[model samples]
Target: RRSKDIRFAFDRVFNEDATQEQVFAGTTKHLITSVLNGYNTTVFAYGATGCGKTHTISGTPDDPGIIFLTMRELFERIQATEEEMSTDLSISYLEVYNESICDLLLEDGGRGRSLALREDQNGVVVAGLSEHHPKTVREVMQLLLLGNKNRAMSPTCANAVSSRSHAVLQVNVRRRPRTASISSNVTVATMSIIDLAGSERASVTKNTGGRLLEG
Candidate 1:
């Protein structure tokens, strides 16, 4: 008997032993630089329940994930060029639950009403979504923790706290050069970090009836 072997091509690959920093350096490091220069970027996670999406994107405080690492790098870069540029940063967090969009960072504490989607020349955006301008890493962490607490969740057979909704964290960074010129263009860019709900089979999650539909 003979066996066939196959080869695959990829921009980058990581092994189990790879650290969180290594992953960020290889995949997301360049995006930060581009974002600083006025380019929008989005990083999302997708897979089945019990997969490593949560672990990779929002790891524990001790091991920090991409979001926190990215924020740290962004602030560092901003500080490094403070003399040459002025930057403004704002953030908004939203969750899609049962086809409804809810603002996670709403002043009313993720309550009130569901936000509406609107579109114009730029693209589709959540209408009247709450935006928070956080100045420091601590403030950003506070908003992140608040948003996480607001995400829909229910105990499942596969996991204790299974996320029942998709959460998106968006950051808008606007930069302008200090020196004035005839064509001093302003740069506005955005970064969206999404933590998507994982798929769970009815058999695996042991959901049934109305619960099955919800799952």
Candidate 2:
């Protein structure tokens, strides 16, 4: 059923008053719990360029959004269960620009790298990105901040600021087998949070900067 809001001509789910924290709380409970069934989940934000997509994903350091909240909750759960089970956790963040993949961490000597995911009869492989090892929640948060800085952000009218490219955060989880005798029963899971490049209405933007050219 479609209800028309003639003023905007489109139905809107969230409005300006929505807080980043509120959004995070909703997603943390829903998405993080489904990670155990060999499934992958993505949270995407789409709106005109200059909209708050970037803010929605990676809000200012003082303000935390879904990405931060999700990471914290997920890792916190993992930590809580550590006493009874053995697990290995790894996490990494990457940026995609014009179809190119760049490493957010280890940039000192790393050249721009491209990442890919391909699967055949066996499984999926994210090319150009090796599995990252993240032990504590704090460590992952640090890497996220580093990655957020490396992302391409610019000013716009749709919002005060916006994201120009896609950003991806990947967390990999592997459970240690009860023992070598029961190693085959061990399970693995992965979760990805993607902050997408906003959908910009060129005319509304006035299209001056490269954004105009790209759009």
Tens-digit lDDT track of model 2 for 100-170:
67777655312455567778543775566655677666677777776777777766666556676777788
Angstrom error at residue 47, model 1 = 1.2
Model 1, 80-190: lDDT tens digits are: 999999899999999987777899876554565888999987688899888888988779989989888888777778878787778898989999988857478889889
TM-score to native of every candidate shown? 0.89, 0.77
Leading candidate by lDDT? 1
- Least well predicted 10-residue stretch by lDDT in candidate 1: 105-114
lDDT of 2 at 140: 73
What TM-score does candidate 2 get on C-alpha atoms? 0.77
Runs of candidate 2 with Cα error greater than 4 angstroms are 1-16, 108-111, 120-124, 156-161, 176-180, 208-213
Error of 2 at 9 (Å): 15
Q: CA shift at 128, candidate 1, in angstroms? A: 1.1
For each candidate, how many residue pairs have backbone atoms clashing (under 3 Å)?
Answer: 0, 2
